[model samples]
Target: MAVTRPLLDLVNVTAGYGQTPVLFDVDMSVAEGEIACLLGRNGVGKTTLLRSIIGLNALTSGNIYFNDADITKAPTYKRARKGIAYIPQGREIIPYLTVLDNLKMGFSASGKKAKRIPAEIYDFFPMLKEHLQRQGGLLSGGQQQQLAIARGLMCNPKIILLDEPTEGIQPSIVQEIEDTLRRINIEKGITIIVVEQKIEFARKLAQQFFIMEKGAIVEKGKTDKLADSLLHRYLAV
Candidate 1:
């Protein structure tokens, strides 16, 4: 049998803001086309982990690898051009920019020439097509989240890092987001690593999971194997 390596790898990654450290010697990997979830209670550094992967937070000590190259010190824009897309916790759409322009921004981040929005973007997010001219801030929270995801896809990334994607959304929209992510993974062959608080959503969306506490991963395994004890210990309020 042929050996397969992870498409994205974090080897002993330790990062933080300024003098205060947050992530401590963290190690993680996501195989090609896999959906992995990072779960934990508040202040466990899940968002910091995602930020580290996207080069937003500088590594204190350790290496990050993507497509077999070390990218620990790469600039944020360089990481984006190298096929890593990050959709942060807040959905961070430009309040005044039209939905079409926000999606174009993602394309521009990849150092690509600005052009017509990709038709496939509409296929993945049909609602965005309807609100192309609408200001992003005027849309509902769920709509904004969808627009954020569609914007990430504009970069044609090999892997996408989503932080708290289902936060502040209604149940119906949550289900839609789940289904669309599955399709994006299966059809587009993009690997995903999501930082999520909702256990049920993580269970349905991810194949592999990691539980973090105090800036380090305490547990990890196949999603189906995640136990109630694990959840109660690390996730319960």
Candidate 2:
């Protein structure tokens, strides 16, 4: 069954860096517990759309609603507190911080209640529990990616925005990440909006997808309806 209410909604949103526009009147939405993907080629403004939702990229014009409440102008911190989490590209794990401290940083960054790593986090990434004292910089790209995601889960977000979760990741870890994401959505009912360019990856995870072209959503539909022919048409640029 489809969710009766939207967990995240972006209506005709225009946003970008100062004096420069990247996303132009983009319209998108994700239902409660739904897994959606923003699909596009490079420089199509998909990342900008995700950043705009988290308040990292300021909106010049538009209204954003979370749980049906307007929050277009809310600060990033406030948005984080409201159960929205973002794990941008490049992983961005602090090189020197211990794995344990990095996990705590997620809770701290959101101002979420919970000083210690939740037991569920260990369940999500058992390796993190093993390397609690290991420095983040020393872990492999896959392990760091796992840590980055685990950090987001520590915040207990209702929805998570992941930009290219599998980019540069090894195939084995990519599969693990895919299974973990499905588990998160099915087991916890958390909504997931992942920005990805890989067809094989996105097709497996997203129930629906929005295809971006030249800064706008040119096509969208249920994952079952998306075809390789469409990919070659709108997303092959």
Candidate 3:
């Protein structure tokens, strides 16, 4: 039998801003086509871990491997071009740009000429098509999150990191986003590493879980028995 390696792996990674270490000796792995969630209380370095994976926060020590290749030192653009996309905590859509233009920006990472918005994008977000001419900032919070996710999809990434995607969004729209993400994962075979505070959202979407505390992962395993007390320590927030 062949031993399959994880698509994304972090070996003893330590990262942070300047000299301050936000992640300490973090070891994590995510196999291809898997949905994994990082759960943690606020200020526990969940976002920092995503930043490290995407090359925004340089690893002070240790290594990062994506698709079994070392990317610890790769620049942010290089990582983006290599099929890693990040939708940050705040849904950083360009406010002044039209929704269409914001989606167009995803093509930049693909190193491909901007063409018509991919049909699949509209399929996943039909509402965006209706509001294509509107400025991104004009959209409500839920709509903007959808736009940001749509933009991430436009990059045609193999792996995407989502930070607190449900934060500040209406439950109805959150459900929509969850359904779309499941479709994307099942249809496109994309891998996701999401940082989420909601247990129901995490349990519904991610098959695996990693719980973080004080800038380090304290527990990790399959989603079975989500009521386990260990999870409460982090989920309590």
Candidate 4:
């Protein structure tokens, strides 16, 4: 069931690295059980914005609220413990670790005694089950991406942030990932905030969208009502 309150809220957030600000006075919110998309071209601070949300990057000012808790200064591990899962752009699974081990790492964030791997995860990505013993570095790119996502799920997150999930991924696997995300949102009620450059992919999956340019939000609205002219102006090559 969707919570009445917004799952994630950023109020007047100003964040960056080492006195160099990448985001300025950015205010955004994602409602419970909704897919919110952050769309932008490369080098527009999209990644920086996501890193700020997860506490991977420092917030020079403002507050971040997750499930109504003030978490502006929370460490990355603390945020993960609070059920904020971040799937970064590069599918950075431990190359030497077996697929099973990487998945187990995700469960550590749950702070519970995990007796068994959730069957639902395998159901979502059957290939993972088949490659339980395989090393992460040995799998194909698509398979590695699936592993990365499965690892995040082990944390039992309330909301998942995906950054450029389709980057360098095969089309078929991209579709698989998209379908799984939709199912997770509909059935499990996991709220999602996806940072994507593919306009069609974002349009199909997001209920609401925010367009960023040069470190600021340039456009935002319901996905269905996203102005084509604005998209053209912001996204044209």
Best by TM-score: 1
- 1-237: candidate 2 lDDT, tens digit per residue: 754447898999998778888889988889998999989888989888988999998889988999867899999988888999899888898979999988888987678565778788888788899999999999989889999999988878999999999989899999999999999889999999999877888999999999998889999999989988989997773
Measured by lDDT, the strongest candidate is 1
Summarize candidate 1's per-residue lDDT along 73-153 as a digit string, tens digits. Answer: 999999999999999999999989999898899888789899888888899899999999999999999999999999999
List per-prediction Cα lDDT, in the order shown.
0.93, 0.89, 0.91, 0.89
Off by over 4 Å in 1: 1-4
Task: Supply candidate 4's per-residue lDDT for 80.
Answer: 93
TM-scores for the candidates: 0.97, 0.95, 0.97, 0.95
Per-residue lDDT of 38 in model 3 = 95
- Model 2: number of backbone collisions: 0
RMSD of each: 1.5, 2.4, 1.4, 2.3
lDDT of 3 by residue, 1-237 (tens): 866669999999999888788999999999999999999888999999999999989888999999867999999988888899999999999999999999999999878889989899999999999999999999999999999989998878989999999999999999999999999999999999999988889999999999999988899999875655976566663
Measured on C-alpha atoms, candidate 2 has an lDDT of 0.89
Residue 124 in model 4: shift from native, Å? 0.8
Q: For candidate 3, what is the lDDT?
A: 0.91
In candidate 4, how many Å is residue 10 off? 0.4
Query: Per-residue CA lDDT of candidate 4, range 95-174, in tens?
Result: 99999998988888777766588999999989999999999999988888889989999988999999989988899998
What's the ranking of the predictions by lDDT, best on top?
1, 3, 4, 2
- TM-score result, candidate 3: 0.97
